[model samples]
Target: MDTGASEVAHDFRPFFRVYKDGRVEKYKLIDHVRPVPAGLDPATGIETKDVVVSPETGVSARIFARTAGGGGGGPDRKLPLLVHYHGGGFCAGSPFDSTSNGFLSAMVTQANVVAISIDYRLAPENPLPIAYEDSFAALKWIAGHSDGSGPEPWLNQYADLGRVFIVGESAGANIGQYVAVRAGVAGIRVKGMLVVHPFFGGKETDEMYKFMCPTSSGLDDDPKLNPAVDPDLPKMACEKVLVCVAEKDWLRNRGVKYYEALCGSGWEGKAELVEAKEEAHCFHLFTKSERAEQLIKKMVDFITMD
Candidate 1:
């Protein structure tokens, strides 16, 4: 009797959907931009190039280096290396997304560091530990170049491997933290980690994680997503950590809590927390507000400070 009504179904939602047949459908919530070719960015004077980190997995990255006579007139000596990861809840987004590309281009000029923005495999298709693995692979590739023996010339000529820093926003922050942990385990030294508006989770976000990574731990308190619950957080590769949050962001408390946990973790490292007054998540990336400029300045100071 009710067979007629059951025959019709609904699909297509904001982020993604799981159908009765186990098919996953993802919605395009934002526009994806093609990455520009390797060359000088006239507006920011940042030279960018894309390189493949792993040919088998097709994982690649966009590298940004400031051109001579660019912002701050370029550094007189080698610059610190900043490896960045973009955020999209592990289901969407890319290093070439306009917002990410623009912000990173400016960041390379502002921080005067040679930056590599990772393009990791997304979820539901590739899933959880895959992105983490890709990120770690990229990290190892960079580390291999520490002695100036790696393939990339920009890294060898301009990047100061000893002062390597890792930075990411939102879900990328989550990945960055894991990368730092793996680095520590591998004896790879990192100068610091900067997590901006990290996208952490509770029960609600945990459901999203499950949808994106069906094979994940499926628990909100999983150490990978909840660093506060991670016993080995003190073993993170970097001795310095900067956690940034915006006042109006829903995830602000998570960042604050992360800062507090790191401070009390007996990690023997310095952890600092910064709050952007009256702002939302990742405001600096999308808008040219005063706080955004402040963030850029703060990042520069952190990257260059002795």
Candidate 2:
């Protein structure tokens, strides 16, 4: 006589589940938070709108610009362009998610820059380089408008295209880094890149990568997941790179390794690492602690510095 024990012995986690036949199930962990529609966020005074980056691929982005001088015209000064990517292990996450929305709102106000948070395709359904490709496509779309002849009025009137920056958090950071690399090869000029708590691979993360990006090399040392292993580190497009890591996060070592590798890569660029002591991965997106505030300030300074 057998029981139903075998049926209950599955590995259905809260985020995602994988079956023996290669079927993947993803659960909506934060579905309750709706994306804030385009307009002025009363709390932060930042105006935002959504635009389609690529209708063919169904990729879009949310643009955030700081409202200036009593919400009339725009800021007195032209602002830098920051193209940001949000993280969810490349399996789940959206730029319109509550955390991402809130952070971008604050960042635009603090950094005084025009930001476009990319809504790239996720994986396990779209797979690995799909997200990377979508992000790079978004970069091209932004660059296409650099001559002030593009359709987007806000970017045309206010965005300083020559001072563009690429930024991301966690898995998004991973994507942003790859996009920056491609930018170098493609001759797209970017001012800098900032990766906050980038999601990198280890022995355990390698399994997740395999499931999400089955077509890739799927090794922990895959250059897509581990920049330290990439031979093109010296070819990064930007002149400066800022990598942030949390002291309590398990992935801190990988972030540090990336920074060290970039510094030693003879990359002809400046690389800096800032460690948030007593914090875990992406703490600034959740908690409003003093440390989180410091991280925001640091990011603002990094982007605005001469």
Candidate 3:
């Protein structure tokens, strides 16, 4: 059998449209929105639901949840929950189309837990904390409220709050890390955070030049520094953080610096850095690479362990 990577190519897919030359071009993820109606099992496939998680700027922001299994209980009663944030360089991408959500759902199936992929607001049009605020709000809602109106009816029936975990890829990982730091300071009891191929503060380095100078993708360049978030938040938060980076990724050095910064802050958390050999940024989302698959299993085990 071929490993996922053996069968997959370099994945640089996007989830939003880039408007230039008066023409709108659809991205890889945008085409995947509102997937085929999914049911309760793998045979029925995954279901995508677009629901408004909250409102920002007086307008509602929506998230699409790809849910499978973990309904009414058998042996997996009170199952664990994984909430995911998709990667689009903080500019574009949807939980519905991200390949990570599918792989994460497989993890949910194996762990007998529920996984949620949040569709937060994107950048340029929305910008900065708009995405962060939306994702953080969604997480807060998961911890404090469950409307039972989400994709998983069984989640409310059997979710194990004690085992709740959070995950994000690429830019999403940064958002996840920030969320964990904030939650820690606020005294919120979340199980753990899984940050894959995260992009830390580019504003602190020359890396912003690579992303902005030519502006190959204006979306990637714009959010390199969002003035909305307090710069001091990193020092105040991010003590015990879990950070993973692809060796070949442009953001690898930044991820390491972020880890070092957190460790230096004397915060009371562990920093786990896993290397993805020969991989690029957002490598884990492809789920087709042998290394990526192995890393996913490793991360699941780490976050799930007490």
Identify the leading candidate in terms of lDDT.
2
- For model 1, residues 1-306, the per-residue Cα lDDT tens digits are 545433423343556766555566778766544445667777777777888989999999988887555432222467788899888778777876677778877777677778899999998678787998999999999998888778887777778888899999999998998899889878999999999999876655466676566676657668777777887888889979888899999999888887887888778768888899999988888788889999878877877775
Instruction: Please give the TM-score that candidate 3 achieves against the real structure.
Output: 0.71
Give per-model TM-scores: 0.89, 0.91, 0.71
Off by over 4 Å in 2: 1-14, 20-23, 30-34, 67-76, 203-205
Residue 128 CA displacement from its true place in model 1, Å: 0.6
* Model 1 residue pairs with clashes: none
lDDT of 2 by residue, 223-252 (tens): 887777888877889999999999999889
lDDT of 3 at 117: 73
The deviation in Å at residue 288 for candidate 2 is 0.7
Model 3 misplaced regions, further than 4 Å: 1-38, 44-51, 55-76, 146-155, 203-240
In model 2, where is the ten-residue run with the lowest total lDDT?
A: 3-12
Best by TM-score: 2
| C-alpha local distance difference test of each model | 0.81, 0.83, 0.58
The TM-score measured for candidate 1 stands at 0.89
Mind giving the per-residue lDDT tens digits that candidate 3 earns over 179-293? Answer: 7656666666667677677765454443322222344232323333221243433433333346788889988877776667665655566668778898887755554778877
TM-score of 2: 0.91
Q: Which regions of candidate 1 are displaced past 4 Å?
A: 1-13, 31-35, 67-76, 203-205
